[model samples]
Target: MESNENEFNPQQPNEHRPEQSAYGQPDQHVTNPSFKSKLELTIFSIEHLREIAKWSKFLAIIGFVGIGLNVLGLGFFFLLAPNMSPFAAEGLNIFAGFAGFIGFVFIMALYFLPILWLYRFGDNLKKAIDMNNSAELESAFGFLKKHYKYVGILIICFLVLYGLIIVFSMLGGLFAAMGTL
Candidate 1:
């Protein structure tokens, strides 16, 4: 039977290989594996981190714009209803105030969502970089998989906070009316 040259020869005496020292054994002088090449890993990690950074920057800009819109809406409300109290009357101004409040809350929540995404993306990016440095591919993917839940919780928390602020504002208005009466 003829063996192919491409096949490994386990039985061959590799005289070119150096003998190990007899203190049990010295460390083998095996050539580093191709997969351990620093250049390839560094390039891959840098590219991945660059992608994350780009997305984070984009989200940050969007969040800023959303926050600006919310502020503008608040300013508009104050300008239009400078002296009108919620308790004073029920009319178009009240409807406008309610609409403004809801719009502000929605805008605030929208701003918070992008911020949350940026944070979670940044966390995952750091984990990915660490994993790449340590050669822990599984852990890097695991961190990415868990990022969604963090974003979801952030949005939920923002909604709860917005609701609390609205409730407190209404309560303060009621109390102020009672104080004046």
Candidate 2:
């Protein structure tokens, strides 16, 4: 009779089996899949998570309020752009306001997603802690991941933009120097 690799041997329980792992059968693709989480959340960790949830919620609310105020300010700015004091040059008032409006809108659009993700993370974290539900905990973690991912991507974009600006500035300066010479 041929011995099956999948069958657990009760007689040789202490012997290391290539097919078995600490968490049952080993994944074929993952070599040495024995890393089990020993992290049993102590009181200190739970308390810290609670504090983080609270702070996240607080910051998210403040962000929302700031966004709301900025929106209101933009509306007023648009309404009063034409009535503003005349600039030294003609049509500069509307152009300045429009430029400001575009910049603000861009900033707000960038700001919104992370704030929303942060809020969801906080809300879900609170629910997870209160209800002790793994599903809610998973959801909270997902939101946190999304928030970080968005911020990371935004940071990369800003870095690229900064690099482009520096390159353009250097080129412009070189051109200006060449023109003078």
Candidate 3:
């Protein structure tokens, strides 16, 4: 049988097809149906990201140092609790111990988590930039999100606590004035 050059041979396939995507092996045409190109805005420069990472690393170091100092201070306070001061009020030492415990659980632990997140953000940002890995870059931003979310929550809690304290103090002052009258 003579081979017809006009007709495509069963053995030969079209080689001009667009490259397939990594996710689904779908051709470029299937993925992007609209011929219009999508444009994305760059809000920050890579230099800015690098600068932020550097600052975050520095802050993380400082936070870890502060946490270490707080732990040491708490331990020292407990160790010296029994040494009675002539000026100390009744049960002051016990109250201090309780306060220290609360500080360890609330302040120290809370501070530590964000510090770790900041540390991770800095580390991931550096690695992502160096290796040009998109996943790592996303991970770095996620750490930042976690850090901010935690801090915001803590701020809100503290604001509410302060508000309550102010309200109680005002009521106490009013009661004290009434008692004096």
Most accurate candidate by lDDT: 2
Q: Kindly provide the TM-score of model 2 when superposed on the true structure, using C-alpha atoms.
A: 0.73
Q: Compared to the true structure, candidate 3 yields what TM-score?
A: 0.70
Q: In candidate 2, what are the lDDT values of residues 1-181, reduced to their tens digit? A: 9987656553332233344432345436644445444556778887898999999999999999999899778856754755662451566767776777778878998999999999999998999888776556667888899899999999999999999999999999999999998
Which ranges of candidate 2 are over 4 A from the true structure?
Answer: 1-36, 83-88
- 1-181 in candidate 1: lDDT tens per residue? 9966434332322332223332224336764333332334467667867677567657667776778786776766644564564533554566666676777777577556546556555555665565543212323333444445656777799899999999999999999999999
Cα lDDT, model 2, residue 145: 92
lDDT of 3 by residue, 37-67 (tens): 3433254667787888899999999999998
After aligning candidate 1 to the native by TM-score, how far in Å is the CA of 166 from where it should be? 30
Top candidate when judged by TM-score against the true structure: 2
What lDDT score goes with residue 141 in model 1?
37
Between prediction 1 and prediction 3, the one with superior lDDT is 3
The clash count of every prediction, one per candidate, is 0, 0, 0
Clashing pairs in 2: none
Can you tell me which runs of candidate 1 are displaced by over 4 Å? 1-42, 77-90, 123-181
